[model samples]
Target chain A: MKQTQTLNHPLDDLLRTDRIPHIWCPGCGIGTAFSACLIAMKESGINLAKTAMVSGIGCSGRGAGYVKLDSYHTTHGRAIPFATGLKLANPELNVVVFSGDGDLFAIGGNHFIHAARRNMDLTVVCVNNFNYGMTGGQAAATTPHLARTTTTPMGNPEMPFNLPLLAWASGATYVARWTILHARDLAESIEEALQRRGFSFIEVLSPCPVNYGRRNKMKPMDTLRIFKEKTLIKNNAQPTELGIDFERGIVLGKFVDEDKPSCGELYDKTCRPSLTQGTAA
Target chain B: MEPAVLTGEHYMTGDEACAEGALAAGCRFFGGYPITPATEIAETMAARLPKVGGTFIQMEDEIAAMAAVVGASCGGVKSMTATSGPGFSLMMENLGLGICLETPCVVVNVQRAGPSTGLPTMAAQGDMMQARWGSHGHYEIIALSPSSAQEAFYQTILAFNLAEKYRTPVLIMTDEVVGHMSERVVIPEAKAIKIVERTRPRGRKDRYNPFEPGEFGVPPMASAGEGYNVHMTGLTHDERGYPDMSVECQEQMVNRLVGKIRNNLDDIIRTESHRLEDAEVVVVSYGVSTRTAYAAVEEARELGIKAGMLKLVTVWPFPERQIRELAGRVKGFVTVEINLGQIHLEVSRCAAGLAPALLVGHCGGTLISPEAVIEAVRRIV
Candidate 1:
């Protein structure tokens, strides 16, 4: 494994390079997803001074600490609400929640649905590695059915959440899915989502070779190859049918995008009469 | 500049007064969930916050409300949330996170009767111990017990100031009666309200450390979206706010957290004493029980017993020095509370056998009667 030691690395200033040698293991796709986010954040032309990132506990949640923008590494399953508070408190700030599937979908599942249902103006990037990577590969909500994990040595019998479908059904205004192999496309999707007005979600299918892959006898390269062979790009495809299957192909693309009044905008609209009345009085 | 205070006398419940107090204290962000006995605080905030250009959010649950409060505070706004015991329990996890990150926020637990949802509308001081030790961890906390609607208003402002000064989570431990009962509350001009804002980071962004102690042992704060890439976590962190999982690191972090409050005990602890100079019996009490204790002390005094009342405003630090000194001089002590012997145990421990500390405690659902407190003081005397 080669480490980048260039003096003038373009991402040096944007990252907490002093905390370099992050905890992500080699071949871990979380780093790839995190890098893409940084690039997207930099390229989106958004005000870095008015942007903040929040994350929960997990390998992917570590993304917040690495980003140089004002960031918060909150408790497990809580990044979404934390970001929600940050956004609502100061509407001028652009808030993003970056965390893993387990943190966002398991303990924080209720918060995820409600934030989406409210159409909170937030950009949520969920890195779905199929299992709880930080906790020695425990089974997760997004773990594929029949996939083996530390907690599920007999193979996970529980079906997983169709993340894109969940976001779409939960009233997300924009939703998309991409794998780590599609970094450029993923960054572009994230840029678009960041520019969107309401609740936006993007699921990055990343490999956890040390956790989910080792149990299934799939090496890092093998998982990458599978992603290349099985991911079929289908723009505007139905979100309910976009489930992942290792042996069979998986559908991926921009599934949902629409204009909608965000929570802040709607709040002002709904309460304008009373608010104005109180102010006048 | 015109002060933000409403500057008027009005009839309001303790919860409503608390919201007014928060507004006077410059609390611009309120994230809360509706729970019985505490829901009025949220309602008042929702109605008033927007009018004041502050933000009010009704979160999905108590936990989210707490998490959002911390988040908003981290965003450099004075933030608060209110809940009952059941909801307060749900907020414990995030409260610990707030403590670890040294975030300044106010949490109002309008306590109701409970082992688990015991009585939603009824009052209890059962959560006295919980407020101090509720969140799992070995760190000191600041909790204020307000006995009336007026004190609820003033103490809530004090809670936010203490939180900012110490850089810790401040708990307002009021009960259902005080939370619901309406009384005349006078809101002073905002100029009269002394608000303590969190100290912002001083040095260059590149050289700044979020957890480095300043003059008062509290680190300066930098809110989110200010271009300082801050990394905060529940894990034991260093002065630079980066995780360092070592025994030495834990000791340093925990000691600063606990010591910052412990060393400032004189400044953080507040108690009101009535007629203690010549009294032989000092009845210790707080929250709703203080009203009963005051009346009981007066009655006991009229009955030729030298009784005085000790009203605890800051209850968590326990006011041990005052109790111990009173124990040396007073004939005995009577501790009154809604729960059975929560503060009584603390009083007794502080008394250290210098004088007998008898408990006049009532089980949940009703307030302790002044007669019952008078009886307890009579027995102790």
Candidate 2:
């Protein structure tokens, strides 16, 4: 594995290499997803000097600290609103929120819906490991029903959110989903979403080998095997029909891409007429 | 470009004046939720921010509002948020995050009665203690109490300056009476208004340590989009801004946080003294209570009692030395606040057996009258 690691990875400059040998356990898919994001950011043509990454508390949230961009590792479940403020303050900057399923969907669920509803220009990447990975794999808002976690030692009885549907319904202009196995496609989808003019959301189903997978009797490779066998790539699949079931299958693709004025644009067009002109202070 | 500061005198409520003051202080971003006694500040910002090229966003909740404010400030724009008791309680967690990250932003709490949303529209100074200790930490904070719309305007600017100068969240702790009552507020011209921008990284970004304090205990800040690659978190961090879990790291991090304000009390603390020179009895007060205490002081003088008042503006550093000195000479001290005994306890601690200290206050939802203050004064004397 060390031999395979090159002295000069193409995206080395984009990463905080000194902060490498990261904390992710071996076989965890978070690194794969993070690599895809870095590649996507490099390809997105956004000015690195004018880009920022914001994250909340969780395993995936650590992505902000590892990135060489001016990043904010904010409090639990607050990356969305923080990125919203960053984008609104300077429209010239491309603000991306990279966080986890639990952080984005559980405590921060309100901010998620509201940012999408306002059609704020933000690229939100949620890595769905299916549990609260950092806090010993507790049950989470996105934890599948009957899936076992620390908090749900028996099994999670709560229903999970269909993330693509939530994003689409909340007015996101772009929505997509993929797994760590679909690295190329995930990177391409993120690149496209980064250029999209309004709120964009991409959910990556990454494996938490030690946390979610081990308790379910599936190793990291076993989860990858399941992903390769049970995944269906269906573009423009109805969000209502999108759900994850390893025994059944998971549909993955870009489901929504449409044009609508973002919150800043609408504010300018609608509120401009009523704005009284005054000399700049 | 339109002026951010409105240059004229106008009659306005404290909440509206706070909005204008934020604008005047170069605050270009406002993120907040609507809460009673504080909603007017958001309303005023919503109507005025766009006109002056600033941004106003009604966030989903108080937590998000504060989080957004911190983000905007980190992005190199002066930002602020306003809320009341319940909302202020919700903001405590993020407010701590702001402090740990050294994000410069102002939070306005136009207080109302509360143990839990006790009275939404009624006035109270019940949040005085909460303003200092609400965030569940051993960190020091700077809080200012404003008495009227005029003070609200000036103190809002001062709050922004303090937050920027110290690179921390400064609280403007006003209350319902001052926030709602309309009065004359003089708006100074833009050139005359003093604004302090956060110290930005000056030289090579690669070599810069984001948490390295200079002569003062504050590091120059580098906002996002400045290509600094800065990492900030709520966790205890080193000068490099990386989390260090050792006991030494914890000591260094927390001490810097507390000592920055603690060592600079002379620079950060502000107070007003009235007729305390030869006084036998003293009244310790802040916010609207100071106004009533003034009235009571005059009434005490008519009765030929040597009474004086020490009005606190910056309440957090708690002008302890001044109070201690006065306690050594004065017969006793009477702390006048709208709450049960928040500021009174601070006064008592400072007095520390040097003199008798008594509290003149009520539970909540009502003002402590001047007559009550006078009675407390007579009793203490």
RMSD of 1: 2.8
Q: Which tens-of-lDDT digit does each residue in B1-381 have in candidate 2? A: 467788899999999999999999989899999889999999998888888878899999999999999899888899999999999999999999899999999999999988897999999999988999999779999999999999999999999999999999999999999999999999988898898888887889899888999657998999888878888877788898887789999999999999999989999999999999899999888898889999999999999999999999999878989999998999999999888899899999989889999999987787888999889888977
For candidate 1, write residues B1-381 as lDDT tens digits: 223577999899999999999989999899999999999999988878877777889999998999999998888889999999899999999999999999999999999999898999999999999988988989899999999999999999999999999988999999999999999999887777788888888768888888988866889898877767777888788988888889999999999999899999999999999988899989899998899989988888889989999999999888999999888988899999888879889999988779988888877898988998888777876
lDDT of 1 at B90: 97
Local distance difference test values of all predictions, in order: 0.90, 0.90
Model 1 chain B scores worst on lDDT over the 10 consecutive residues at B1-10
Per-candidate TM equals: 0.97, 0.97
Top TM-score hit: 2
User: Every model's DockQ, to 2 decimals?
Assistant: 0.57, 0.64
Model 2 lDDT per residue over A193-262, tens place = 8888889999999899899998988899999998899999999999998978888999999999998888
Off by over 4 Å in 2: A1-6, A273-281
